[model samples]
Target: MTANRELDDILRRAADGGRISPEEALLLYTDAPFHALGEAADTVRRRRYPDNIVTYIIDRNINYTNVCVTACKFCAFFRAPKHEEGWSHPTEEILRRCGEAVDLGATQVMLQGGHHPDYGVEYYETLFSAVKAAYPDLVIHSIGPSEVLHMSKVSGVSIEESIRRIKAAGLDSIAGAGAEMLPERPRTAIAPLKESGARWLEVMEIAHNLGVESTATMMMGTGETNAERIEHITMIRDVQDRTGGFRSFIPWTYQPENNHLKGRTQATNLEYLRFVAVARLFFDNVAHLQSSWLTTGKDVGQLSLHMGVDDLGSIMLEENVISSAGARHRSKLTELVSMIRGADRTPAQRDTLYRHLKVHWTPADDPTDERVVSHFSSIALPGGGAGGRTALSVIDAQ
Candidate 1:
């Protein structure tokens, strides 16, 4: 068969819910026509979410500490063990952030941070439990397999035990941090000290079995090959086939700024959208795919809704990691609702588990919480501090 025919066949097969191999995925990524590829992926999305409703979460990424031992080359967020700038939030400060998130209509709080050597599983347990005790309703979707692995090594405990302790301490779910690119070459080149890609998956699998579900993420750009990109998702697909645990797959571009790996490479808009289409068509088992507007910008994020993106990840009340790496896009709750509505899909506020909390069926009924803004300069300061503004004061300013 000719190349066009083969591409059409693969697209048709995938759109119809048939699983595509990594090789086939690479072909679609590199050779398939963009519009056709997107349509096929859209077909798959419709199959999964027939209601044509797009979902978003209102959450805050509370970076607990900047003192990291595993200094990733692509990271502009972490500080060395005792860097003068390094800081870890006190439990009261963390609780304050959580309170801010709740007041802004956020349903979840992602406790993102670096691997501080001093922090063992006990640290997370204490923090998570404290947050839960303060706000029992806020979903504590924090950390990932990489952090879990690091904690296990630090605390001299098994991986399973670490996850169990955190879960018992009220870690609702794991966010997909530390999954830069889940292949040997890129993973090692970017984050050499972090756990292996396989080990990352293993930790996630253990979390799934332990009844603590999580999400899968991929950091694009960072000088990875096209084949390696496909390999990354394929690895996640293989694991998803086994455990059926990953709640979503969020692939975002690498923001290179103020970091050691600055401008070495970055995924373009076309590359990001094509990969989103390809990932949706490829992962038959994963239930949701998120568009990372934090790194990719809002226009592409809006475009992704039709390209098999079911979730426009959080109208993040605060995000520091990507913002620290030069991601400048900021969004508001009403603006996000308008974007989803403009895309011809009903916008719904969802919880961590993808359950719809509220649906905006008409423009007049859309939410109007001005305080639910993305990383404002005054808010997402360095070192996970909530800057000098009190949450309510910020709200009053709005």
Candidate 2:
């Protein structure tokens, strides 16, 4: 078949670490046999990371404010600005949360949230500075282009300067939180109020040029066509080709439990795994591809290591966003180590920069850190923690 020849060529080129076009990527993503695709992708992964180590980071996703202006339909985490139930965590409260995370062995704190109307560059500068001052060792992996654009507009400055000010105030790296789909159709359909895909990449380009590295992310299963998914990867690859600032690319499925989109157009587990493999094959320039255990459950996360992922993502000590949307998966540090080992790869704890801190070779020598549990369920926060975490601050119904 003509299709078979095209796919065969594509897989050969891909396995050889050669670049494939968007069209070719789509063909492989949709048409190739699952096992065949996984084989090529795993080859690429081994070639890229030959160390045979599967990595994970210990961090806390601190949502500074649930009050947001650009309310995406797929979000159940954010409350509209001025809504009675909306609230922002005071600076000290955020610091306390960070302190708790630090005490529990978190080296990085992901400060992500809704675009609060009042928080501009200065607001972030002060917060980031304080977090760095209090815990100079904590990597402030916070904010992406969407928040940069919002803060720039709020402060009446350019995005470059916004990044400059935040970086100066100790924003060590950026988190690719707001890049929902990157393509116009699915992006607008889900989050019309957010910045355009081009604009997101533009801001990241500026960040990359400024020596500030960042990770990129995608939220799939939100009614996007296979072609659109490939388009998203292509857009990211083009940007990575120029800047080389994206440290990793993370793709997660959209949860439809409590969001406005309401379970209408979610990607299946098969599609998620396929994209993970396709991303590995496509993003040859990017160094790391992470598998999301939070959204897709543990089995897929383990399988992703064999497919294409070198990183198991963060052992989130505190996560409210995805948990709010009904992602209930959780694990401890030992559990994660076991998962990686079971996948036939050495388990390692990595920093924000993907530098391995500790690598385990033998199962008998595995770590026994009881304190390093996945704090998603039984988080030590007040108001009953993440499992029953309602809101950091909520207003009276009146």
Candidate 3:
């Protein structure tokens, strides 16, 4: 058989919902025609979601601290311990942010931040328990396996015990923050100080067994090859096959700015879109796929709706990590709905677990409040330009 014929067969099988092997996924990701690959992924999405409805989540990313022990090469958000700029929000300030999120109709809070050397499980326990006590209606889909590992080591406890304690302290679910790239070479190249990729997955598996669900994420464009990208997905797939703990697969591009890795290389628009389609086709076992407009532009995000991206992700009341790394894209609730409608898909607000909370069937039903915008206080990056302060933190005196 010809090589073209083999690629065609793989595309057909993927479009029909057949599980594609990692090798087949790489072939489609690299060799298949762009439109053909996207079409196949769109077919899969329509099959799973016959309603033709796209979803977005209203959530705030509450960065509790900017002091990190593992300062990654690709990150522009972390400051070393005792650095003049390093700061941790007091428990009262963190709770106040949660209160603002609740008032703004945010159903979830992603409390992610630097791995502070001083913050043990006790710190998170106090913070999370306080948030739950104040807002029981909100979902606390915060932290990741890396944070869990950090806390375990900090407190001298087992990983299992750490997860159990956090779950008891009101950690409803885990977000895939630290699973940057699961492949060893890329994972180490970017974040060598972090826990190993295997260990990250192990912590997640333990959390799953403990009955705490979570999401899986991949950070692309850190100079990894096509094969490594597929391998990253394979790692998550293998674990998902066992625990079924991952709720969604979120793949985003790496922003290169004000960081050690520098702006040497980044994922192109074509590469990102292809990965989105390929991710949808590859992870048949995973129920939902989210597109990241925070890193990628809105056009790419809106285009992803037709290319197998079911969720547009959060409005992100505040996001400092990616913004600090030079991601300039921002959106309001109204603009988000328009983007969905412009793509010809009905817009629906969803919770952390991909559950639809509100659906806007017509223009009249859409939200008009403009304050629900991304990055309420724009981040003042290293070089500095606009915006007075970083996200989820008190705005510095202008």
How many angstroms is residue 365 displaced in model 3 relative to the true structure, after the best TM-score fit? Answer: 1.7
- Give the Å shift of residue 248 in candidate 1: 0.6
lDDT of 1: 0.87
Spell out the clash pairs found in candidate 3.
none
Evaluate candidate 2 by giving its C-alpha RMSD to the native, one decimal.
2.8
Q: How close is candidate 1 to the true structure, as a TM-score?
A: 0.95
Local accuracy by lDDT, each model:
0.87, 0.86, 0.88
Which RMSD values do the candidates have, in order? 3.8, 2.8, 2.9
Q: Where does candidate 1 stray beyond 4 Å?
A: 1-3, 377-398
lDDT (tens digit, per residue) of candidate 1 on 231-326 = 999999999998999999999999888899987888899999999999999999999999988888889999999899999988877777887888
Give the CA lDDT, 0 to 100, for residue 113 in model 1: 84
Provide TM-scores for the models. 0.95, 0.94, 0.95
